[model samples]
Target: MKGLKKKRKWIILGAAAAAVVLISIIGASMNGAEVESAVVDKGQVIKLIKESGTVEAENTVVIAAKNSGEIRKVLVEEGDRVTAGSKLMESEVTSAQMDIKSLQSDLAGLQAQYNQAKNLADKNKTLYEQGALSYEDYNASNTAAKQLSAQISSLSYTIKSYEESSGAAGVTAPINGTVTEVFIKAGETVTAGASLFEISDLSNIYVKVDLIAEDADLVQVGDPVKVYNEDAGFTDENCKVRKIHVKAQEKMSDLGINQKRVTIEIALSQSTALRLGSNLDIEISVDQRENAVRVSDKAVFELENKDYVYVVSDGKAVLREVELGLEGEDFIEVLSGLEEGDVIILSPEDEIQEGTKVKV
Candidate 1:
């Protein structure tokens, strides 16, 4: 109570100063207690988490060779628009063709043996039924026929598979997109799994941002985000929080503070008109309130770790404790102890006591 009284005493004195002629040269009245008051009003308040990150190509598709061989021809060049399954390049297929021919010959030989075994098995079955061949011999002949058939079928599939793969060495586009890069040239040797072309659709780009671990959990997929390039005056409202990475990485801030950051992926519109890998400022909208009662930060003074503002009522300053919600750079959310149209002293000068009278 004593501390509160002392704070009011200082504030009242400051109010008396507001009336004095610090600007007496301007012909201000020195007798009237001059003070400034603002009518509390309701406005929109939004909680935004801001971060900076770079735009990257999303859904980039890589075209690779199916076989390790020399590039016979490059059908499509870089920057070419291609559809799915469009041939990008042809690989050297001479060796693959020869391998398939050898398998085919082996398959033919196995088929002939299988036919002979089947004929023998049939004869043995008839002989055994007529009591001329033993049961054991009949079963052996049948088993031999079945084994030959199995070998022939297996070899035939192998030959068919080889034939199919002989054409696979020709690299094709896996998706419809613009080719951003081509890694193989005519007569250049490229191994399987080696990237021969890189294609990007550019229909949708993503801005990869990192947020602190705590903030990451607050934002979710499908939340709207704003991205802006100040120099270019470009902004995209269609950007949405597409993904929040589960892994958190440790990063050092400009202040050298260690922060656990989780990467967030947001999709931006194709209209940014900027190249991939460009950097931009982004703000993620976490929460919003419409027509929320707000007061200027200058008016809310802290006392005992609490916020208090003075409202003038009937020629007296009424001290009221306020519950604040969002602390903005210019104004704060007034959750309680204030209402619309109520007049509060703007940065209530120190030394203004409760019940003190001042002219607005």
Candidate 2:
């Protein structure tokens, strides 16, 4: 009975070993299959070019004093709205008025002298014709009359000049606008031709953008543009290109790189939120594409400075390098190395390897 028990134990042990071998073979076969993964579908993408510039009134003027004098009163302050011919400031014209009055008095005196000289010359001429006066006396009297007339004409011109100067003491606005700067105070003295105020016609404002010469050709007059400013609270306002400068300006720092830039003036159709001299960030659409293949920026990887995407084929992870075209905010355009039905891995981890088994 002990020998029969020993034989049964041996049989049980052999059967257990065979079952273990079969299970090992099955596990190895399952591991050899390719891993399955999720992929992104390719579609159309749109590209945008960005630039920064400042907002300015299309019609702006700098108010300067035509004649130098002390500022006695300022009619307007910064941020004041004014109309055309509005008084900006008044200079102390007390001396100017005195000079004008003196000139006028001189002109009157010259006119009186001229009238007396003319009467005397006429009387002398009549007497000389009648042989009552000597020829030398009449000639002298005629010459004196002509000289006095010339003097009177000269005085008239002087008086007109003084009048113009006196008028300039009251500075006036050339256009209807808002006063952006007030450089002179009520009691300050300013020199002639010095800027005292800056006025901007906010009704017509524009954005000035500098573009590199290489890329300037892509833009043209009448092109649509969008402008925005974070601080001034401006966003995506419709605007059109008003002007484009053709001259190329040299780059400040680089010598070998000879580049010309264009200044594009874009007129804002809606400027309710825009302010004069407000810095703005602009985006211009040079070209647009519809229904293009695109992928999330996170899925795209860089290797050796080259772009790549991980694709799933036959349930196996395959890394494929691709060429990129236009880049957007959340997605990048795929120019090559992808298809419409191809599946790709999203947010791949470092530990994931090729041919590794994946549930998704």
Candidate 3:
């Protein structure tokens, strides 16, 4: 019994010495490595759908060439402001002008022929009444005069039509707005119905974004949007969702993924700084949490389909499972396993293990 008791005492001493050595090694390890870390803090976490969009006019009108002709001169350029009835461009002597001259010349020739026919008809009428000419001959002379008169009238009507069509050579603005696009240049021959210009009242414009089907469903009309464009000095929060398209369009993504996207329009209450067709970034808050404990997304990682984060505690890395909530562009909400003021490792490496010693 005495020997057994001595053996038990020695065993306890040996175990204690081993524990001391282990602790020393752990202490050395804790002081050896350095890591970057951040403290968990409370702030607003907004779930936003980020998208790039284009500035577009609410009411864009495409002006087309009124007549097929060579453009003589363009009076207005892009960005020029004009009022109704302002001449946007003028066409050189067009085919219609030539047609008008030809019709007038034909009418003059017909008028001279009618004058000769009428003179013969009157002479034939006098001879026929005096019983010196046949009835058939007199009737033929009268018919010739009437036919020439009809031809002259018809030619005059055609000349009037050609004259009216020639007025289209001078293209004018139908509305008061700024020219946003100019498709025609001087000396370019364009066919009728070809695009000439695009004009719009740019005082009010809207931003158009194509959101995926899932994100589109989360947004509603009247939801406020934030528009950002650093180069254009446009950072506006007064824009609101105006329209959401009912149908989705199939588009190919940059990664070659097929996606169904729906178009949405955001109306800007004041948009003087944004130019038409300029690209801008937009953010719409689909969900938000106020005063929520959040951490940088870089600090959180995934393992075995579970979310985890490395927490700094007692100069050691403590692997903790985190229940994530709302995720934003920069930060993510931590519903559990984290607290305010708790320091966490940022971008923990793959080799970082639980209970590993670390220095912040």
TM-scores of the models, in the given order? 0.58, 0.63, 0.68
Q: What lDDT does candidate 3 reach at residue 163? A: 55
How would you encode candidate 1's per-residue C-alpha lDDT over 1-360 as one tens digit per residue? 999999999999998887674666244333334678888899977778888988777779876666677888889887788998787876665677777777778888888998999999999999999999999999999999999889888887777676556554356677888888888789888766787889988766778998999989889898889889999788886789989998999999889999999999988755655676788999888877678898888899989998899998887789999999886646788999999999999877765778777678
- lDDT at residue 89 of model 2 (Cα atoms): 77
- Model 3 regions lying over 4 Å from their true place: 1-32, 92-169, 251-259, 269-271
TM-score of 1: 0.58
How high is the CA lDDT of each candidate model? 0.82, 0.77, 0.87
Say which candidate scores most in lDDT: 3
Roughly what TM-score does model 3 have, to 2 decimal places?
A: 0.68
Which regions of candidate 1 are displaced past 4 Å? 1-39, 53-58, 64-74, 90-168, 183-194, 204-208, 230-233, 238-243, 249-258, 265-280, 297-304, 308-320, 328-330, 342-360
- Give candidate 2's whole-model lDDT: 0.77
For 92-167, candidate 3 gives per-residue lDDT tens digits of 8767777677777888888999999999999999999999999999999999999999988887777766555555
In candidate 1, position 198 carries an lDDT of 93
